[model samples]
Target: MTQDKLIRRVLKPVVWVLCLGPLGGLAWLAYSGGLTANPIEFLNRYLGEWALKFVIFALAITPLRGLTGWAGLTRFRRLLGLFAFFYVVLHLSSYVGLDQYFDWNAIWLDITKRTYITVGMVAAVILLALAVTSTKGMIKRIGGKNWNRLHKLVYLAAAAGCLHFFMMRKGVQLEPLMYGGAVLLLLGYRLVGYLKKRRRKSRLAVA
Candidate 1:
């Protein structure tokens, strides 16, 4: 089979199932009474952690593609991004519906009072914008250049997410630091690429 068919017909389905595996595990845990004493908190944290992980995975795709010369890797980026957003929605929903019980007042207070929640909300908003404009129709309507510019905010969202995770945790934790380091490395890679491109263009112009 052709590469495209392999990706579309076989790999995509496998990846899709793999993406849902976490949620399925969560469901099983819930049913089996394994979510710990604070189930709501556990659910929120678990979903939020997975969301951030998917976001990092999506961000890594471009760099990975460039390094490996596997352009087909781009095909899965959107799917991973959407799953990141999906888990983010579930994380937020758990906080709002299950934890807060739709208490808008308490929610607003938590958002205002808790720095981590505020940062997380900002990240969520950025992800929401990216998800909304992820469609082909939206891309055409916004123009390719504009859409690309808007999507660059994914880096900001990722950074904010890392910060949110860091601040949400008590004391100095290793997990958040590791996540933050990964984001920094990814951002560094992009910055180096941009600088090299600019230098190459300048040399061509001079020549």
Candidate 2:
């Protein structure tokens, strides 16, 4: 089979299983009395982490594909991005349902007044937009050029997610720092590629 077919048929299914395994594990943990003392916080924080992880994974696709010369990797990007959005929704639900018990006024206060929550909400909103327009129908409706432009918002969403995670911490922690650094590296890679493309375009114009 061709590489692209292999990626689509074999690797994509494997990736799907791995990506969703965490949610299944969480359910098992909850059922088995393994969610620790603060189950709500555990689930909220855990789901948020997985969502950020998928975001980073989606962002890493370009650099990884460039380095490995595997164009087929791009096919998996939409799936990864959608999973990120899925987890974000779950994270929000956990926070509202379990943590706040659907307290709209308090939730509004937290979203508006709390720095970490506010930034996290901003990131969630950006992800929601990307998720809503992730379909082929939406792409056709928006036009490919416009869709590409709108999807670039993922970079800002990632940055905001990192900042939210960092600010949510009680003190200095290495985990958030590492996530921030990874995001910076991915963004730096994109910047370098953009500059190279611009330079190539300029050289072609001169020629």
Candidate 3:
């Protein structure tokens, strides 16, 4: 098989394995006394980190394709985005189910009253909506133009997610700061590209 086909063939399974394998490994660590104390916090941290990582993955697609000219990466964006949703769900579940004991009212109060939680919840909702409508059937049903418009919301979702992470912590941490920086740089690349295109168009019009 050609290199491209080989890469494509292995991509899905590899991503799935890498994503879930860690969760299983962590669970095993907890069961075997590695995370004996405060396993719930460990689980929450893992899920939260994955959610932000997935957001970064989703955001990286356009920049990656733009920089490397590997258009095929666009095909994986949906899967990456859905994985972000999965992690966010897991993160929230860990809090609600494991932490809060399924207290609906308390959860509701936390969501509404807590600024960081509210931002994160809103971002998650937007990601979930985008993921649900990501399929071709939904695209056809919604119409391509409308779908495109809706998908643009991913940028806002990503920004909100980053900010949510930034605010959730009491003090600045290097790791999350790095994630935010990467998001900013990736987005900056797109902005610069747009300006370049605009400048070229203006120069042509003057000529």
Candidate 4:
């Protein structure tokens, strides 16, 4: 088979595993009694970590396509983006439903009173918006340029998410640091690209 066909053939199963493998792993751990005594905390942290991981993967797509010359990878970005939202929803549900015992009043108070929770809620809202507008019909209605500008909200969401994680931790743990560093790298890459394009446009204007 040609390289293109080989990639296509491998892509579907790889995406499935990448998407569902974490859930399977969680289930396996749960079945094995690997989750800590505080199962709620375990679920919350696990789902949140996976959600952030998916966001990082979504952010990496453009850079990976540029570096690897795999243009077809962009085709999977929407799916990955939705997966991020899926994990995020799971994370939030774990908190509100399991942790709070579905106490609407307490949840509302916590959201209002806690800065990190407020930040996380904002990020979730932005992710929800992005997910809802991921369809091609919405893209047609919104126009690509507008859609792109709106989607740039993902960077902000990631920042808020990292801040949420960092603040939620009791101390300066390595995990939060690692997630923060990865987000910084992704944002820094985009920043450098933006500057380079600006310089190129400036040179063209002078010419």
| lDDT for each residue of candidate 3 in 1-207, tens digit (9 for 90 to 100) | 775786678986787677686589777887788864788877887788888888888888898898799887887788888888989999988999998889999999989999988998899889889988988899999999999899888878878888888887779888778878988887888789989999999999999
Return whichever of 2 and 4 wins on lDDT.
2
Local distance difference test values of all predictions, in order? 0.97, 0.96, 0.85, 0.92
Candidate 4: where is the Cα deviation over 4 Å?
1-10
Sequence-dependent TM-score of model 4: 0.95
Q: Ranking under TM-score, best-scoring first? A: 1, 4, 2, 3
TM-score, candidate 3, is 0.90
Taking every candidate in turn, the Cα RMSD to the unseen true structure, in Å, is 1.1, 1.4, 2.0, 1.5
Writing each residue's lDDT as its tens digit, candidate 2 over 132-153 gives: 9999999999999999999999
- The residue ranges of model 3 lying beyond 4 angstroms of the native Cα positions read 2-8
Candidate whose TM-score is highest:
1
For model 4, what is the C-alpha lDDT against the true structure? 0.92
lDDT of 2 at 3: 85
60 Cα displacement, candidate 4 (Å) = 0.5
Measured with C-alpha atoms, the lDDT of residue 112 in candidate 2 is: 88
* lDDT of candidate 1 over 135-167, digit per residue (tens): 999999999999999999999999999999999
- Which pairs clash (backbone N, Cα, C closer than 3 Å) in model 2? none
